[model samples]
Target: MPVSKKLPQLFYGGDYNPEQWPEDVWLEDMRLMKQAGVNIVSVGIFSWAILQPNAENYDFGWLDRLMNLLADNGIMADLATATASPPAWLAQLHPESLPVDENGVRFSHGSRQHYCPNSKAFRHYGQGLVRRLAHRYKDHPALAMWHVNNEYGCHVSRCYCAECTVRFREWLQQRYGTVQELNARWGTNFWSQKYYAWDEIALPAKTPTFANPGQQLDYMRFMSDSLLDAYLGEYRILKQITPDVPVMTNFMGAFKPLDEFEWAKHMDVVTWDSYPEPTAGIPVAAAMQHDLMRSLRGGQPFILMEQVTSQVNWRQRNPLKRPGVMRLWSYQAIARGSDGVMFFQWRQSRAGAEKFHGAMVTHTGDENGRVYREVAQLGNELKRLQALVDTRIEAKVAILFDWHNWWALELDSKPSRDVLFLEQIGHYYKALFDAGIAVDFVQPHADLNKYRLVIAPALYLIGPGVSDNLEAYVQQGGTLLTTFFSGIVDENDRIHLGGYPAPLRKLLGLCVEEFDPMLPDQTNGLRVRGQGDLDGDYKCTLWADIIRLEGAEALASFTADFFAGSPAVTAHTFGQGKAYYVGTHAEDAFVAGMLRRILSDLGVQPPVMTPLGVEVSERRAEGRSYIFLLNHLDQPAEVQLPAAGFTDLISGRKLQGSVRLSANEVLILHKDTEHAV
Candidate 1:
């Protein structure tokens, strides 16, 4: 977790807002926290209004007493800088700090994240508060970690105000270094959109009809960088004052507005909030989020910063988390490589918008409630499971994920409106997850030589260095699988000249002559022509490419499209390994069968085979493997033991045969072996 020396165990608490309750209830919070085996609590996340009521007035007496009480009770504090929500006084003094929407309407300062990213007034006040907090808490005994500003771009990712427009011009200047280069890259000569001066450039605000795709893509980049500048402002101050205290900000899983890969580089440790909807694909989606967080920093152990104890108050239909579902999800996070299990809040609120939100201490203030009892049980289990901290899930497979590609591919003038980046990512990742194969999410230009199998899905926009990086990986005997619509455009959202997939044509041994984007209600069939392993007749939808083979051989052909006999799937042998291309978005049956066969050819096996609803994952450290078996079904299920004998950490039971698990069950087993780390 890379925290202070005072916190040497697993973290197991949530947001603690002592300012919400009176002094009497504050004392009760300490008692309940101890009773629930809580070791750490996030303090003062949204207390700016009370911390400093006026511009010159500061109140620290209550917070001082709370910190002392927590330290005396043997609890650690994940202290927030209190910069997420601006106080009412700041808003009244300078309303220009308020953010504006895309339609040129400025939002009133009532909700959280109401300030603009480039507002000078907001930065001035935010910096002042951060300096004071860092100086005051540098040597405090309760301080273990520093929480930067809340979610980076929850509501106001893009601001169309005059202030932001001026900054966007400056960003463009720095990015291009000259007006001539901006014109050349943006391809402004296409539709009489060339700019003669820097002042002519403006924010991608509401435009009549369609805006320039190049301009819109650059605006997304500018917005992402502007938010990053806000984080770095507070981070530099915290590090200069308290260099020993680790600093981080909470991330929303798979958030598209801001680039998480870039943000993870500056953080001391990664942390994110997980709020998966109660749906059929909950297990796979939650695991994908965990893997994405863990992969942000090259497989560093992250913390589950915020999750619901039971029912949340925000969703359209908030469903109460069934009994044992909370614990099951927590263990799933740890299984993928999370060091801590935390929640959105410690005690449920009695007022405000989040009063109905579940917490460790319920509104009834009873320690005997169903949700509170489950929280206590899980906290105690975490205390005994501290040995699993810092362990890693070492997967040999890597999934390429790039935010630039995602943003550019989903721009307005694309081939198909139904084609999205995350959907294709989910398709590829689910195939691996359902087979019980752990996977890591990586950027396009990252080092891919360590992985045996690399899967890139819907890589519609390939930059300069990415092609070289991927080509070298395939040349060095690594298996690569990419889908349709890849290698189409460069970083500037300009199509590559000569042919489609131009950069990767030699490596893939095929060319996409044309993209046949199917309408939302259309479908296509996939006829298997590979080895007699998969279903002969499979269907696809959303997209099918007319592929022309250069040196590759067809593995599957489209059945109902104009290019029915053309290659829908092809396999080519590049330098010492193989590269497969799927010219169509086939259904799960075909994708899963092909991926499983490829993994079998590489001799990469799953940890253990289980029933349909059961998930198996393993983490290894110090010559020992910790196996996690979770049942995501509503009914009981059984799994065969993959080893001769092992010790169960949850029940302290030793077994050598099959084990039966009730609904929503979890069994963390330990076995000694030499893992190929």
Candidate 2:
């Protein structure tokens, strides 16, 4: 389900904790919310303690009044299950609910997410509360969407307690079936750690030197699944009681612990929280995260569930968002593929852990504040652009972002500790972003037919059928780009044996004899062979695969070190498609130049040409497209419009030639005459 049927426009507003203040303050909140054009408020997210003050007693009196007040004010409620953090009493009554760290020390109460996901007692009380809340609020007119536990596995992703140990073994048994297969997969024979029985297998905790790599990978999977089970426990109950409400949980963007792709399968709609540091200044990392969340459901529009209006409180030194940064970032979210834009709070707290966190209504209790004004302006813009709701972003290029590969590649025993997964992905993503090209993030197992070009950056782990899928895709005339250290290991973190990049060696027509892992300060030069923009030498760093071309032609060669004049990059024509492999991590300029050449050959072009610091994105709906132009700089920038005259949705002005946008400005252009405008 999408957001509730009643919210036809963009769902706005955010976390509102009325129980944190006096009763009279709620009326003022409603008044200010309407002034700020707030249409929805996520309430009761952290209200478990107040809602059920004791084990046997429950209170719906205040919630009933709050719901009625919200409906009367024409605001919808993204009603939360309030199961994120259990009550202090529950932890006191059942200490087993607490999570124990890898060091085997149990965490105490006071902080949030202290409960162990696999604890039976915790699940019982948590699901019980969810059932009560669901039944009580099922028919409430203000209920819009069901916000499941807030940011699952945020603080405590794993527990080394005995309960988790038992659950982990059961999970392993279910996956591998027998102790013999477990030993084979985990490679237990290496350190004489072979287990004769299922009970002998231990959780991959702090070992003498290092835990088995395969065991560590499996434990990550188990922890993700265990937390997912906890979310599903409440989800099943909520669906059983209020089947109409759409259930969702906020994901921390680019979070590594949980496999969000698997979790997205169970979510009614995808949503995530974004909190980028201001110093980064609109980095490509944040854009990649937005596209990643959009790709979770195959290009479906997701929600901007939680963003700070200004600065975050958790960072060591929280800096305020410069004048228009909040609005710029909010539009960036929508431009990528967000249907709704919401913040982490409606009002700033007077006292709490998040007292300093930015909010729509600050502690000064004035609607005339700069943050409030910017919030109201964006709200009004969203109200005007209601036709853009439910639209989707289309991309001809996709980058594979796999969580399994991320975990395996980051393990302790990798060739180069400097080889970071997301950094590698960011390199490719930034190339495309700077070129004004639209791109989608995809899973390695997702269908490759939709994209003309697929780039897999350091795809270190190739799971079952991925090699075959890529082979088929390449043989059927698709272009693929992958970097060094890819296809080196299987899903079990076991080497593919014959050579590096084992499975893809045949497709790429190359064999890597060995890897040359470079230190941080080391560097090499890559001399381009053919013409075009990549005809010069470029600096290569981090890693270099000693490659020997089989059926592929060398496009570049190492110009330094003992492997000088060796193949550093190669391209092969397989059937009707082409595959290119970069055996070394080259500089950004080389990657961009090579990508531009490849994209040109594949007939892929950006929607519009733009100057640096200006971002362009498009969303399509009802046969019409809306082109978003945003300036991320402190100075004015100009963008040439398409030959066809278009109307600016924000300014309601028709433009034909080049238009200049002021610093931190945004424009939504509708191509020619459009529908539902």
Candidate 3:
């Protein structure tokens, strides 16, 4: 089933906290929302304290009236369970409900997510709240979808309290089944830390030096599973009552602590909050996040759950979005496989922690303000472009973005501190993005037959079945690209025995005996062979592998350092396909040049040729291809269209030749011969 079957059009509007406002103001809010074309609003996201004022007292009358008002105004509700935070009384009555910090200090109830995930009282109360809300709103006319506990693990991801320690032991017991297995898996014999019983295992906290690597890695896994357990507790209750409505919680894009891919499997719909800093000016990292979120559910379209309308309040010096930039970013999300565009709040707060956050209705409650006008215009545009809903973005290139690798690669002690996983992934993703090539992020074991090229950057941890998958893909005529520090360890962070990059050594046709890690100030050069974009010498940094070429030929060799004249880059012909290994972190120019050469050799082309600042993306649905061309520059730019004329769905303009797009403008194009405008 789709995320929201009842409301198929692009879900507009955002979080609406009517509980914070007076009854009269709520009526005005509804009127303004209707004027702004808002059809859905997420309510009661953090209203737990108000919903049940005291432990024994229940007060959902205000919410009941608010729901009725929303239904009467033709607005749907993405109803929240009000279990994101427990009432203050719960913490006051049971102190164990509060989370304890790494230093062993218990956190108070001032902030949200203050409760411990494994606390018995907190889970009992939170699940009870979900049960009550689900039963009451199971048949409500305004209910579109269920918004579970808000942003799980936004804070208090892991608690060092005694209760969590006990629960962590239980979790370990369930996983290992015996103490001997635990000892072997954790490699506890190295430090005389072998456990005699399950109770001996403790939370990794406040050690003199670094904790046991295996223990720490398992703790990370347990903590992620602990949060998932809390979510599942509420999910079970909601599904038992209202099985038809899809349940979702907003995910922070590229969040480090929790394993989002594992969480995505439990969620009925994948949604995330996007708050790119205005100073960055829509960096490639932000685009990568959109692609990552979309890839979480196997390339399904995700919802842009929360974005600020103008400025955010949390930053030190908040900067407003430049004119036309908000609209441009919204379309950017749509082009990247977002089915809905929403924001953090519907109305600006008069007084609260988020008073300065941008919203659709300002504190003055002016519906005709610039922010409201833009929101309304975008809402109208979504209505016009309803055909784009449920569409999928097809890509011939896939990039592997595994969180297990992310967690293990950044451990306390590794080969190099400067070896960052996302930075390496971004280097490759940015090159493809700048080349105007659309790409999809995939898990390590996902099917690779659909894409002609696959890029797995810094794949430090090779779990079970991943090696076989990559080998098969390469052997079956799929070009593969991997970088330094890949295939170095298993899921347990133990080194593969034979050599560096052990499992992939055969596929890559190279063996590394040692790693030449350089400091931040150090640099090396690579001498490229043959005549192309990669013909000249290029700068490399961070790491260089001491390579012994087995069967592959060197495309480039290090021109400096002790590993000079070694294979800095190698290519091997395996079966009908080729595998390339980059032995060092190179500059952006080198990465782009290498990508261009590979893509050219593979006969892969960009969707359209555009300028550097112009972004090109395509979505296909019902035998129609929708091409989005966005100009992200300060000045107007021109794009040459294909010979076959196309129609702009936004402006209903038919054009055959070159088209000029204004600064921060967007065009949704479809073949002119297919549809009449």
The model with the greatest lDDT is 2
| Steric clash pairs (candidate 1) | none
TM-score of each: 0.98, 0.99, 0.98
lDDT per residue as tens, model 3, 1-677: 33687788888899998877889988788878887778899999999988887776677798889889989998999999888878889998999999898888999987788888899999888887788888888999999989988888887777899998998899888988999998887788887998998888789988888888888888889889999998899888888899889988899899888899999998888999999997686457878999999989988999999998899999999999987888899999999999888998988888878999999777777777788889888887787887888789888999998888898899898879899888898999999988988898899999999999999999999999999999999999999999999999888888888988899999999898888889989999999978466899999999999899989999999998677898999999998889999999999999999999889988888778899999999988767889999998889999999888898888888977999999999999899767532
Among the numbered candidates, top TM-score falls to: 2
Find the 10 residues in a row with the least total lDDT in model 2. Answer: 1-10
Task: List model 2 lDDT by residue over 49-157, tens digit each.
Answer: 9888988998989999999999999999999988888899999899999999988889999989889999998898888889998888899889889998899989999
Q: In angstroms, how far off is 1's CA in candidate 2?
A: 8.3
The local distance difference test score of each candidate is: 0.89, 0.90, 0.88
Q: Which lDDT value does model 2 have at 565?
A: 95
| Candidate 3 wrong stretches, greater than 4 Å | 675-677
- Cα lDDT tens digits, model 1, 535-611, are 49888999999988999999999998578878889999999889999988898989989999999998888787778
State the local distance difference test value for candidate 2.
0.90
